[model samples]
Target chain A: MNWLGLVPFAIFSLLFLLLPTFNIVLGAFRTQQGAATLDNVMNLAQPRIAIAFWVSIKLSFASALIGCLLGFILATTVALGGLPRWLRQSTLTFSGVASNFAGVPLSFAFIATLGRVGILTIVIREVFGINLYGLGFNLLSFWGLVLVYLYFQIPLMILIITPALDGLRREWREAAEILGATGFQYWRRVALPILWPPTLGTMALLFANSFGAIATAVALTGSQLSIAPIVLFNQIRGDVLQDPQLGYAIAFGMIVITGITNLIYIVMRVRSERWLK
Target chain B: MKSARLWSYLIFLTGVMYFIIPLIGMFEFSLRKRRGEYSFDAYTSVLTDAQFQQTFLYSLLMALVAIVFGILLVVPTAYWVRLRLPKMRPVVEFVTLLPLVIPPVVIAFGYIRLFNTSSVLPFLGSQFGTDVLLSCGYVVLALPYMYRAVDTGLRAIDILTLTEAAQGLGANWPAIIFRVIFPNVLVAVLSGAFLTFAIVIGEYVISALLDRPAFGPYLVWIGSNKAYEPSALAVMTFAVTWGCMALIQVVTRFSKHTRTSI
Candidate 1:
């Protein structure tokens, strides 16, 4: 009787989440004629598809690594480094907004701030005589996308890791100090170990987050750039391959990568939670 | 401690600048419509445009539908799981998080394939049906935040005891849920609703693929085609997002105040 309450949610998830994903996975293993084959997966080995995957991996890796590092420093400053209390609250509140604030408006904001005739571009040129475009800084380039991705990625990391940092009790530090451990030694030996799981997990989460993002890249660079999600977007919109099964294969590949990364993140979160207990 | 505090101030200021500068630039650019001087011409132009009003209203209505459906679905399930099925938490959580991992384009693709004109359900059979599908997509996308907020709220209160007390008073399940459980978690539901509102308002991919006139795709349309108007739209979008976040803060603080006074 109690189990009946979950029926609606179960039906919703099965219809929307599980079945659609299963359809893609199943379609990836079939040809257009409905015959089972491995050609769809093999098509992923082509140079164009492989290069798309490579570019995506490089972007996700660079953004996640840099975002993790910078976010950790910022989170530490707010949660432990002892700024004003209101600063922490305001930062967190803003992080919540900035992290969710992606897609078209986000890209528009970046362009208004950094485009060739942008406000900052004009200011820097007039005041310091520095031409950002002359420095090869295109807002539509690969590195430019990373910079835009970081706008949200850093705050996401701060939001996720702040609580873990707060979990670092004062007693642990004092205990290590009493045991003749120096500050550096204490952090290296004690704090680092406890934080490893969450830090690594957050990086993995960020990797998956960036891997699946499409709108920001689309809005900023248009269809000219060849990121994984953009490739998938074009394929979905137009079936550019002329082979629907091949399109499913590309999406399946995306899911596989993000799924693995998310799995790692979940495992690490469980490990860290056990340590907390 | 003094040196550490100084370092904190330095790092915090740097982060604040990184976040604040783009917003300031967007606002300044939005005002630069009159050439060599700042004015509100861009804002006036955007606010006066008929398409802007149309798309903005469309997205606002869609956001409301998503919030209502999200609350109706999430609150009861969260309450029931807390009240009865503790073992189902992990399964429910994983399902909710699935939307985050799946890109919006992928989901929209799935919707196209799964509910096209020739499909069994045929959600895209007509414009109204397609709008329903778009709102459903928003609910799916916002599921993670909505479920987590409601679940966290449920956890804060004594669910089993409250339910039993309501039951002992001869109340039916619906009354117990609506009258008793709903009020207790109203704050959490409102937080989730505001977040959902923020997310659904500026969403582009799903609506664009579905060929809906959402504010998100309209923003993109202007962004590629217009000059200063895109900056004006950016400022407007940022203001809407900021307003939602402020409302969340106000709701949370109000809840705390009421809880303490009681």
Candidate 2:
């Protein structure tokens, strides 16, 4: 058999994933004239990089947490047959559409819907005499980006949470009821514990997902923000660093962060499988 | 108990509002006539706009290219890995998937530096070349979903035995992989293709980065000008995507029914 064809696939995967990273790591460790140096990485250890890194972590955590919880509530409501089948299906479909929706067009949709000159903002100001700008609803701020991310993030939560709810085992709920447990008691004593691990896992995936995403920040907030991938994108195109090497360095940093987050996700997923089994 | 049921009904109503209200707003904004009553003028104007029409075609063409290549490439990778490389499974698994956890913007940046002028590859020297390079990036971007579907489908079939049987008949690996093994994973490929189509058709990051005049950039154009046309475009985009989603559902149901009957 021609097992050698397999070699091409193996090599292609390795090279595609490796070479870009290689260019970056190599660039970051090189002199201005291309001699070996550690200055780039060392400079990254400076206070500015640290602050940006910490900020990204905190913001990603906040958005992912809120999104996961929102997703959980919505998913449980639907999965418990809180809605009829047709409605549930449509909502699920809409959730899929919204969750997949991101980038500039998504930002535009939100801006048109909620921006300063946006329809809702105009209507709210006209009908209720509520100044949204006074209320700080600008679509060009850190919080504004978070608000737009919520559009998709909540739907992602539903996608992950609905499956877990399906596996909730209705018999367990019935058994709890038979034992004279209240609904909250039944959920607390039985359901939440079973769902906790995957819920945690799903939330982590969402965190990593929104964290790595740069387009939302790009379209909504631009480089006035300090998000890592946004910074990296600017380094590449904006050339604020004024050197292609800086672009490689930023790409290298993004890869490392995404790699680490993905590792955590893999571990969590493994744990979830174990818990379920 | 009756009150709890009523509470559930209320929750359902809220859910409907949550999903439908945004769409309703998009529709009202799209259909309203500035000079008169409701009209189809905005949509007709959007469809007739040459750039919009071209971008729509360009996006459909990009999606079709990725969908075809994704099916051809991912199916074999998923199949060959399942049959021959069970020991190296997780590594192969993670390799195809590293794209997902890595943000698209990061990858888009990677493309710029990796493919920009004066890079190792001459292909990145121009915008057209960069656009195709962007397509390569799209293939990678869609890899996680496509690979996952194929991997799951491979697990559902006993491919090793089939490979052995084909080998015993003096069939070579390519013949077996292409003819016998490929047909078995059709459903997975179909589902993955639909997903790839949905993703690539509406893709904005790679297109925006590579500075291609695809549907996403066109949408941004319409958004800045004819407000109602942009809303109409959004509704159309939503319809197309939802249609693909419905295709996935139908394919899954058809596959499920087939498995049950067989």
Candidate 3:
């Protein structure tokens, strides 16, 4: 009787979530006439698809690395830096909002700030006499995308890692201080050992977050950038690659990469929870 | 101590600047429609556009449907898992988190292929069916947050005691779930609902691929077509997202206060 209660939820998931994903995974393995083949997955290694994956990986890595470092500093400042309570509260509230503020609107905001004739660009040109376009800064480039992604990426990192930072017991730091340890030594030996797991886990999450992101990329640079999501988006829109199976292969590859990163995050989170507990 | 504090404040200030400058630029650019002086022409144009109004309302309706559906699906499962199916917690959790692992584009792509006209179910055969499919997709995208929120809420309240007490009063399963557990976790459900609204309102991949007239695709369309209007839409979108988050905070704080008072 109790098990019967899960029937509706189970059926909903099976029909909507699990089945669609299963269909994609299954299609990635099958051919046009439904014969099993490895050709689609093999085509993932082709130059264009491979380059898209490479660029996506690089962007995800760069943004995640920078987001983690900057987010850690900001979170640490609030959690341990003796900042006023109101600042910490506002920072957290802002992060909660900013982390969710992605997709097309975020890209538009970035373009407004950094694009040609943008406010900051014009200000820089007028005040400093250095033209951003003349300086070879384009908001549609790879680094430009990374800078835009950082808007949400950093906030997500802060939201995820702040609790872990708060979990750093004051007793441990005081004990380290009393035992002839400098502040630097305390962090290096004690805090770093405990914090590394969550930090790395958050980096993995951020990596997956940006890797799976398509809205900002598509809305910002259009087809000018051939990141994996944009390539996938184009493929979905008009079958630019002329092979639907290859599209499935792209989606499959994304799942594999993000799946691995999220797995790492789950494992690291579990390990860190053990210590924090 | 002073130096450390100074360094912390400096880092905080830098982070704030990084986050705030884009918003300031977006607002400033949104006001640049008239060229010679700042004005609200961009915002007025976007706000008055029929497509904008239609798409925003469409997305708003879709968000409401998704939230109601998500609550129905998640709250019950989370409640049952806590009360009876404790052994299935890990499986339930993994299923909930699968959305985070699978990208929205992939999910939308899969929906296109799996539910096409030729498929057995054929959810994409008609506009109504596609709308249903899109709403379900939104629910899937939001499953992680909704499940976590409801699960956290369930954890906070004593599910076992509540169920037993309701049963002792001769309450049926549906009544117990709706009357007993649902009221208890309303705050969590509201938080999840606001987050869902935030996500669904600005969603791009699913609605775009499904050919829905949601605000996300509209924003992207305007962005590609115009300049100042995109910034205006961005500012408005940011306000909506901020409002959602702020409402979640307000709801949570109000619930905490009420609970304490009780």
Candidate 3 or 1, higher DockQ: 3
Judging by DockQ, tell me the better candidate of 2 and 3: 3
Candidate achieving the largest TM-score: 3
The best candidate in terms of lDDT: 3
lDDT of 1 by residue, A1-277 (tens): 9999999888887777777777888889998888999999999888888899899999999999999999999999898886779889888989988988777888888898998888888999999999999988898988888988999899999999998998998899999999999989998999989999999999999999999987788788866688888888788777466667778888889999998999999999999997665
Ranking by lDDT: 3, 1, 2
- Give Cα distance to truth, residue B235, candidate 3, Å: 0.8
DockQ in order: 0.72, 0.43, 0.85
The chain B TM-scores of all candidates, as shown, are 0.95, 0.94, 0.97
Better of 1 and 3 by TM-score: 3
Candidate 2 chain B, run of 10 with poorest lDDT: B253-262
Highest DockQ against the true fold, candidate: 3
lDDT of 1 by residue, B1-262 (tens): 7887888889888988888888888888889889889899999999999999999999999999999988988999999888889899888998999997787777887888888899898999999999988998999989999999888888788888999999999999999999999999998899899999999998988998899999988887888888889889888888888899899888888888445111
User: Cα miss at A108, model 2 (Å)?
Assistant: 2.7
Residues B59-82 of candidate 3: C-alpha lDDT, one tens digit per residue = 999999999999999998999888
Worst 10 residues of 2 chain A by lDDT: A12-21
In candidate 2, position B152 carries an lDDT of: 81
